[model samples]
Target chain A: MDLLPQLTQYAFSGLSTGAIYALIGLGFAIIYNSTGIINFAQGEFVMLGGVLTHFFLMVLKFPLVVSMAVAILVATAIGVAFERLTIRPLKRPTPLSMVIITIGGSIFIRGVAMLIWGKDTHSLPPFSGNEPLVIAGATVMPQHLWIFGLTLLVIAANKYFFYYTISGKAMRACSYNRTAASLVGIDVRRMVFLSFAISSAMGAMAGIIIAPLTMTAYDVGVMLGLKGFCAAIIGGMSSGFGTVLGGLLLGLLESLGAGLISSGYKDAIAFIILLLILFIRPQGLFSKAQTERV
Target chain B: MKRFVFSCSLFVLILTCSALCGASQPIKIGALFSVTGPPSFLGEPERNAAQMVADSINKSGGIKGRQVQLISYDTGGDATKAVQLANRLIKDDKVVAIIGPSTTGETMAVMPVVEKAGVPLISCAAGRKITEPVNRWVFKTAQNDNLAVAKIYEYLQKKKLNRVALLTVSDGFGSSGREQLKAQAATHGISVLYDETYGPKDTDMTAQLTKIRGTQAQALICWGTNPGPAVVARNAKQLGLKMPLFMSHGVSSKKFIELAGDAAEGVMLPSGKVIVADVLPDSDPQKKWLMAFVKEYQKLHKVEGDHFGGHAWDAMMLLKGALEKGDDLPATIAANLEKSRAFHGIGGSFTYTPVDHAGLAKDAFVLVEVKNRDWVLVK
Candidate 1:
């Protein structure tokens, strides 16, 4: 009946969006850390998850669960292929060239998707149902819950992989010291490829979960990718925890700013905060400043 | 002497045949639309509708014994690209006239180029600015944003809904629409209690709607094309806002209904007769034209034609009429178009004067509502 419920409603909405951004940020962090390339196609993998799933569910008449898993797998394969076809063949490129290749790859992927699925926006019905459950007078759709739950699961899984599993640890080591890790027989290139595959899988999962709320279209990857990349940079490009925090903060700030100030200024508000953070906390909020070896 | 005479006769026959082929060369119409970007819902239909009109006209016997040749380029809703394509159409393809450069942004962007090139450009975009300044080379078939605003206010006055909130996108189309909305608000006795603008690519607009909910507005008018307006409808229903919702002509498509789902029910918008083709009286001038277009468009695209498509149909039909009335020269064709009067097309009867290049009347729009997820004529 008052401001509290409204604020809570905005907060819930913010959290749901934050979950998607976190997933995207997590993808950005993994790829950026491992290969030092900001994979612009990271968002496209997420986009492919939704676009391919929509195609499967609507056109192919595939069952929901199968379509989803297949979408994720398809996106993962595309990400792996992106590395193989675009990244690997460049034989010894300058860092800027690699970044440009990813950008080109993103544009190419988008154009292909546009051809397959025309530029109109397509939507999937919410998983379970569309009805909202009221909590403390704030309406929350079941899809929001799905997004939140999946995001936490992804984060926990990534933590376990990086901390406890050998493959993830090797990938982390490659990011930390590629030359040293290669000397210690880490197979740095293989780790880089694995990181791309893993992060792409995460992005695909995010797309699938969020597609029900935010409809999918061919050109959605560009802006969403930019936001995720911003979140990653703000969260400390190297720290997974910081990336998640950054994504959530960006989402919350954007939502609250929109609600309180103006929707027109919401994007500007987020970017200004990012710029301020970049200027002040260049090493990122939660990241430890690692000194470069001379 | 016999061999030389035979060669001279053969060369004369070849020259005559070459002249005949050149006479029947089709009129080139440059077509530009977003086709593959955010606003493709508007551009794709315009592209398809223009092509359909061209194909049917040629089939019914070529215009002036010449087929219509359409050289279409996908602008992807980018203004800079539209300008480049316009130049290419003028310089490279050498189209006699340009039909579209879909969104208002692209239309405005390419206006100067088309004007400077001295080529006729009949835009499928609805920004009033296209024709207001009256560029000698530019014309438009899309109803002016102000005319659409007037149509909405006419319905609102009848309903006695005075206080309204306006939410528009921050693109050229929305900005221009906002100007009309504000400029005409006082004239219509509609007090805009809350005004808001949103990003074109934004997926959600609940924050703006929430702020509007706090106002004493009797109705809400959300002006945007495709996904943005659809999102507003969904968000309004999600928040259970009690105020009646209205939309601009931009969301006059089945795509909006599909995206908004149940949320689209009872939401009104001012659109053309394309959606209500079956319901129109047989004697109505627009009926036959609308029926023919709907049949051809549905047959081709496997979807219903919206107002965006109608805009293209009108523009192409106008250009076709001009081409038919005048010679292939661009200046003559532009003059013939300026002389258009009582030419009934899909949108409405058009009358163009030297001062007014856009031919459609203010009554071009009809108020329609999404009832049971279908476009229903509002009585």
Candidate 2:
């Protein structure tokens, strides 16, 4: 059989999944850009958002809208508190130490989540019905549309905040040069915390939207977080827009691989692509070429 | 000097009390299952059933006038964790016997530990390897894939479905079933038209199903756990491929219906007759036991118990029966289990011999079809 149609189907599936990866990648990008440290707990933020929403809406019988709002708010507060307590104290520590701290934070958060929610897979009702919409002999779930649309909206909002808003510009300045930003009267520490808060909120939003599609469990965050980190790295970890692009590409690759090849190797394809990209173009697909600094 | 004497006297008294308590203590059985991880669906149900059996047995004055205490640990579906838990249960908890570390991988990992400890282990999982290469202490209560596959072949032969396409998950359970089907297909004079494989977490199977649709197979044989069967049913409906679908007993759970929805209709699979029979003939010895278990389980859990729960109940009952007869808890339990003959269980009448640990016959399963979203006996 000709592989074209199969490849196309794979592409459609990949794009849907890639949209989710991009959202997660963008969250990583936002936090890394501001804090100069990878927030390993970013995926757990997504998991927390989804699981908390499930508890509030389904188990507690709260209205869906109210539960979602509360989930986001709680996730944002946690993001801020995490930065203020764990990350803020490690400001003067080595970058390696900060990275290790974030990893530790991720483990701690996952443990607490497991203890609180137990390890059952929890799912919420899809925002739309579960019917798959067919287009050109390919079917896509309605929830995939939500994931893609939300990714776009968040990206646009992030762009406007960073480029147009004064607070956003201050954060940007701090990312570029902390000493210069501080000299110019920007509160560098507060900006760092704000970046974490925003990034965490985005991560949580991604979790809430995708939870209905994939279901959520305590340990689900580890893989998602790793994949999102890979996406960010492949897209140039410093560039938020590039991270989104990288995530979409990774998602499409995975889906196509599952369709044409073995479904068992679907996850492996992403890491293979990641390794190849790093070997050939270490600067990433969209990042500016930079000389090594001594 | 007076204070020291008083403390010494208190210590001696505590030691004496503990020794007395230990001498007349209840029998402790270690139960391990995956309370966390992916297989929690199977493991959680097994755990609940095990606890229910233990509670019921104790309420009935336990085995031969001594209470039975169950100490359970979560294996998390990890082999390493299974070993650690088995060690803890044997060495630390000092349980006389152990029930499970459900799944083939975990069971195999903990087999050496249980064997070394000289404790009898009766597993609830269905991997035949647990009983083979034969450790004297290890016995499985659930029917292995060989029997399940043979039943499938029998059903297909009876229906005159000579041409079949197979789709299976590429996991240990799926691969084992596939091997059995392939081996038995020629014996039954059935033609294998097509074969496809998918992973456990796969959400879509349209591509595989589409390929299978082109084949002139009379029926589709799917081998996997929950979402796999559900996905197949949904995709088959979407492709408008109308043919009988046969599944292994692994998919025999209520969650299959919840996941598959309307697509679950007309799907036939093998299930233990004790669980599927709406009205058992009064002549059958297991009828009362099955009904009582069904009623109590439903009353307490507010949900119908499946073959998994029934299997757990049978395993516990076997242990109870053994404990009642055996003078030395471990050695006697093992001997009694081996000598078990015509024990009426919720699954079927079981008779364990030295060669076979799973005492029930392949005929114990009745072909069941989902009609109007409820299981109906087909044979």
Stretches > 4 Å off in candidate 2: A1-5, A238-241, A291-294, B1-15, B21-25, B34-44, B71-96, B113-118, B156-167, B189-222, B226-248, B260-287, B298-309, B364-374
Instruction: Please tell me how candidate 1 rates in CAPRI terms.
Output: medium
Interface root-mean-square deviation, each candidate: 2.0, 3.6
What C-alpha RMSD separates each model from the true structure? 4.3, 3.8
lDDT of 2 by residue, A99-179 (tens): 898899889889999889876566677798877777666667788899989988987898888889999888778767778
Tell me the tens digit of each residue's lDDT in model 1 across B1-379: 9999999999999999886867568889999988876777778889999998899888998788898999999998899999998999999999999988887788889988988888999998877778888989999988878878888888899999999999999987788889889999898899999888999878667777777777789999989887889888888887788998999888787888898888899999988878888987787788888888888888888887777888899998988889889798899999999988888788888999999888888767788989887888887
lDDT digits (tens) for residues B1-379 of candidate 2? 9999999999999999887876568889999898777677668778888999999888988777778889999998998999998999988998888998778889888888988888999988888888876678988888778777888888889889899999988888899888888988999989899876777655557667655665689989999986667877876765566788898887876667656767788998887765565555687677788888787788878877767777778889888888777764687788888988888887777888888787878766767888877888776
- Output the number of the TM-score-best candidate: 1
TM-score of chain A of 2: 0.94
**CAPRI rating of model 2:** acceptable
- Summarize candidate 1's per-residue lDDT along A31-124 as a digit string, tens digits: 8777778788888888898898999999999998999999989999999999988888887856799999998999999999988887778888
What's the lDDT of the predicted structure labeled candidate 1? Answer: 0.84
